[model samples]
Structure formats: C-alpha cells, structure tokens
Target chain A: MKIEGVVFKAGEVPKTLFKIVSGTVRETRNKTYHDLGHGDYVALLEYLLEEPIQENIVATEETEIIEVSLEDEYLNIIKRIIELRKVIFESSIDLEDIVLDDFNFEKVDIDKYLEQVESLLTLSAGDLPDDRDEALRVIESLDDDKIITKVNLVRSFIEKFPEEEEGARLLIETAAKVYIVLNDRYVAKSLLKKLLLHYSDIPKFCYEAIKTLEGIYRDEGNIIWRRYNKIAKILEVKLRGND
Target chain B: METIEFEPGQEIIKEGEEAQYIYMLKSGKIKVQLGLYEFVISDNNPEVFGLEALVGEKYTETCTTVENSKLICCNSSEFMEIYGKTEVSKKALESFMRRTAKVLGWI
Candidate 1:
C-alpha cells in the first residue's frame, strides 16, 4: 500500500513488518536518522520482539511497501542479531560524540564521565571511537584510585584502542594491578594477556605481563599454574635475549 | 621466487620503513598491523602483503609472524619480472582493493 508520513509512531507496536518495494523511509530514535531504502525491513525488530516500537518510522517520500510476515525462525534470529548489532554500533557512535563534546581542559565531573565509561563497557565490538584521543586524555587525567575503582570499565575503554598507545598501556597496566585486589583477577589476567599481545615487542610491558600473569596463575591449582608456567618461561627467555 | 623464513614474534616489516619487497605467505600465520586494526594472513591465501613497494611508498603497516613462517619475497623489479604477466598480478591488485574496501567500511 502507498504510505506517507508517520507510518509507525514511536511507542505504538507495529505488529506488521513491511518490505519497501520503492521509495524511502526514515527511522528516527533519539534525534538520529536511519534512512532505509528499497528492500529494507521496517519494524522488523519491533515486530519480532513484540515490543513497543522505539523509533518513529516515517515515509520521507510517498513510498510503496508490502506487509510481510516472517515465519522462518532461522531468518528471524538472523534479523534480530542484525538489529541488535545496529543498536549497539549506533550507541557507540553516539557515545563518541558525547565524549568528544565533554572532553576538554576544563575540570570534568568524574562521576559524569564514569557513567559514560560504564556505557562504553557494554560495547563489545565496533569501530574505535574517533574521539579516542580525547577519551584517553580524560582517562589519563583521572586519579589512579578512581580508575582502579572501575577497573573493568577502564579495561574495556582501553581495549577499544587497537594499538596500545602510551596512555592506554599505562591505564591497562594500572587496571591489571588493582583488579586483583578487588577480587577481580579475571579482569587482571585478561588485561595482562592484552598487554602481551600488543606490547610483545616492548620488553618492559612484556616482563610486567609475564610477572603479573605468573603471579595470578600461581594462586590457582597446580594444573593451571603449570599451564601458565610454560608460557611465562618462554617469554622470560625471549626477554632475556633482548636485554 | 626467493623464500625467507621468519621466527614467531619476529618483526618482518616495520611501519615507516622503506618498502623493499612484496611478501606472499608461504606457510604459518602472519599478522598485519594497521593503526588500531589487525588481521591475519595464513598459508594457502592468495593475497600478498607490502604492496607499497610497487608504488615506492613506505610500508604502511608493520608485518610480523605469529608462528615460524616462510614468505615468498620479491623486490619491485623482481615482482614485475616474475608475476608481471601471470594471473598473480591481477590477484594481488584484487586483494589490495578488497583490503581498501574493508578499511573504508564499504564491505
């Protein structure tokens, strides 16, 4: 059927999905525009979840769409995953904008920034935020205790950088040290492993990772200790040759 | 093709270094480090690394071996003399295009 404007209002459950046979529709949520063109699915995620539609799907131009029912469970799952990824990825982009905006030399409210970092922790996979330089600046300016208090969030923040910059390395190393004190040795071990992966060429960080990782493994059972022991020994030999 | 072997954790190429050879993975795993992104090239892959040498550009990324590995190495003139007319040149160009597309998020 031909449609024009406000096809699906926000908060209204659009029980049916539409295949855009022609023209375009704009999906807006929280002031962001997600334009959909030919062959795009409208309200598919909302329909699949049977939840209130969170976005206003409006026909930006007089558009043609066919109401379609999704019956294949496998395809529905794939669609759900795609929609979820879009949500998470877009959230990262939005957070990057907010970080860039608030990141400045002026004194920052630590609690406000901590809330932002907590949200960033939820993003497991996506492009590194373009505002990472400012983000790192903000992270670096924080007190060690503040970072350690939220070490898991700090680790996730640093891991977003592909290469370990000086600031990032320092932050992750600090996180590794204090996470164990908080009884979160798992985060410590993972950060230590990340240090090894990115800084293998640098003996200083390599030795630190090997030392900390060994200490963490030592607290485990004999089998786990022995398993980590072999790798640590190999890295130690490599570090010695570089010295 | 002249073959060179790199031990695991060895730095085969450094970013900003002069591009010397087009490298083809012969065996084992190699990591290509670009900015904040990394991808692996393994044995039996038809792609080549260090294409910057062909254009006389500096190596854009550092390449390192993740395991003891062998690579087919060819300098610019050598590459032209060897894979110049063969299907390998086309494949190499295609690989470069695919990687460029990925970096641009076009695919």
Candidate 2:
C-alpha cells in the first residue's frame, strides 16, 4: 500500500508487516533516532513479538510498502531476537546510536580528548570508547589525510598517558587501519615500521601494533607477508635485546 | 580474501545493515539468528553467508560471534570470481550430486 500519511501509532499494532519499498518513514515516539528509508523493516519485530508498536510510523513522503509474511520458521527466529535484544540492553551500554553520527571532529585536541576518555574510563572501568570503532563503523568516516594526522598524535598520547597505555596503542592501531581501508598502504606500512622502532619498549603496545600490521597486510600475498614477517622478526629481536 | 578477528558478542551482520563481505568461518563458532529463530551452531557448515544484499535475499538474521573467532571474508565480486572457476564449480556440483544420490538410495 502507498502511504502519504501515518500508518500506525505508538500504541497500536499493525495487522500486516510492511517493508519500505520507496520513500522515507519517520519513526518517532521516543526520539528521532534516524529516518527509516527504502528496504527498511517496519512493525515486523513488534508484530512478531505480539507487542503494541512502540513507534509512530509516518511516511515523510509518498511511500510504498509491500505487505510481507515470513515463513513460520523465520517468524520464530525473529521472536527470539526481540527477547535477545532486551537481554543485550541489560548488560551493555546502548550502542544503538554508535553508527548514527559519523565521527566528525573539525578540531581534535589529542590531550583534552584523552583526559575526557580517562575520566570516562575511570567511571566505567576500562570500557573506554575508542574513535577507531567509530571509523570502522563507517568506513568512509575519515579520509587518508585525516588518518595521517591522527597517527602523528598516537606517539604523543602514549607518552602522556603511561597509565592508559592500552588506549594509546589502540589509537595507533586505528590510525594504521584508516590508511589500510583507504588503500593507502604506503602510509600504513611506514606507520607500522615506526611503531616497531619507537614503541618497542611497551610489550602490549608492540603486540597490538604488530597485529594491526598483520591485519592491514592480510590481503597482501606471500611476498608482502614475508616482508612484514621480517619487520616482526626485527621487532622481537630489538625488544628482547632491550629486555 | 582477508582474515578478521571478532570478539564474543560482536555482530558481524545486523538485521538491516547492508551486507558488504561474504564470510567463511575459519575458526570458532558464530550464532546466526533473526527475531526468534537461531540457526544451530555453524561449526559443521562451511557455507558462505552475508550475500543477501548482493543477491536479492531478505535477511532478518544477525550473525554474532560466540567466542574469539576468525573469519575469511571476500567482496562479492571476488567471491564470485573464485566461485565461478571450473574446478570449484565441478567440485561443488559433484558434492551436491553425492548428497542427492545418497538421499535417493542410488549411491
């Protein structure tokens, strides 16, 4: 059915499951989390769960929804997911909006950010939110130049936060990943080599850096793997010598 | 193909998220599910999944790691290229026929 107006209210359940085929659906009742566009599900979960629809589904424009019915097997599966979602929400911080906002920092002060993260980690106990996950959430969030800028800050963060060493290591690893995802392997390679030499003293730092390098070069064939293997060999020897 | 590691409870694919890479389980088990139904532990099956967006398949299921897991992933185009190979195609066909023949009592 084509919808130019509201289909269901917050308290009512729809008779049939409808999937957005074209145009947008405004999901409001809580907060506007995000707009549901084409190929998005509507009322399927609520209907499957036999619960009242919790959101106001209104078409932002001319919207087409094809009525859909799942196989009994599939309907059973969706019911379990609704239950699982509640269980997950109870255990972890609601990460539903993690991908909604792209990590857009026009001015990123590395030190101030670390301080904020440190305080947050103190309260939450080691569950610091790393910006790398944000970058990975949306692959196009950071460009090559932006990632390079972040990598340069990794060393300084490590130096400043000896107590929060893991966060620093994560930053460096994330920076390298940005370059890898962008196919700027040269920058990623150089960053990994420098980490081996510069942060070789910290065992956890070296381990994470090497793993990030491995992940980045995982697509590269045997020859490149051998080259990366050589770097690891040297890093191990240097680290042992320092010990 | 590339190998990626995931921690327990990490959602590799969400219910409505665009399917990017087709994945093959290398090690460890993953729970694949939709709202109420969960597929059995995917330890025995070596089938590739997360291809619905590439093809025209509707996915209500989300796949999450059960433990520290390793998976090999390839883009749709890359997987198709390898899957389209004559040797791979022949082996797959033979495997299917063998299973069908056994079921039919013609083995």
lDDT of 2 at B16: 62
Candidate 1: list runs displaced more than 4 Å.
Answer: A1-243
lDDT of 2 by residue, B1-107 (tens): 89899999998887666657767677778887643335534546554455443343343357899988888888767765776434433332233223222222222
lDDT of 2 by residue, A1-243 (tens): 898878788789666767788988865533323356676666544554445766677888999987765432232333333333433222222223322111111144444544454354343222222454443333234345455434434544445444454544545665566565657554555555545555556655665565666555544421134233444555567678878
Which pairs, if any, clash in model 1? none
Model 2 stretches astray by more than 4 angstroms: A72-243, B1-107
Q: For residue A59, what is the lDDT in candidate 2? A: 87
Query: Which lDDT value does model 2 have at A227?
Result: 33
- Measured with C-alpha atoms, the lDDT of residue A231 in candidate 2 is 44
Evaluated on CA atoms against the true complex, candidate 1 attains a DockQ of: 0.02
What lDDT score is found at residue B73 in candidate 2? 82
Give the per-residue lDDT digits (tens) of candidate 1, residues A1-243: 999998898899877778888989887543334577787777654554455766678998999998865532223333333343333223222221223221111244443544455466553222334577765555556565454444544555555655646634664566465564555665556556556555656766666665666566555421233333444565578778877
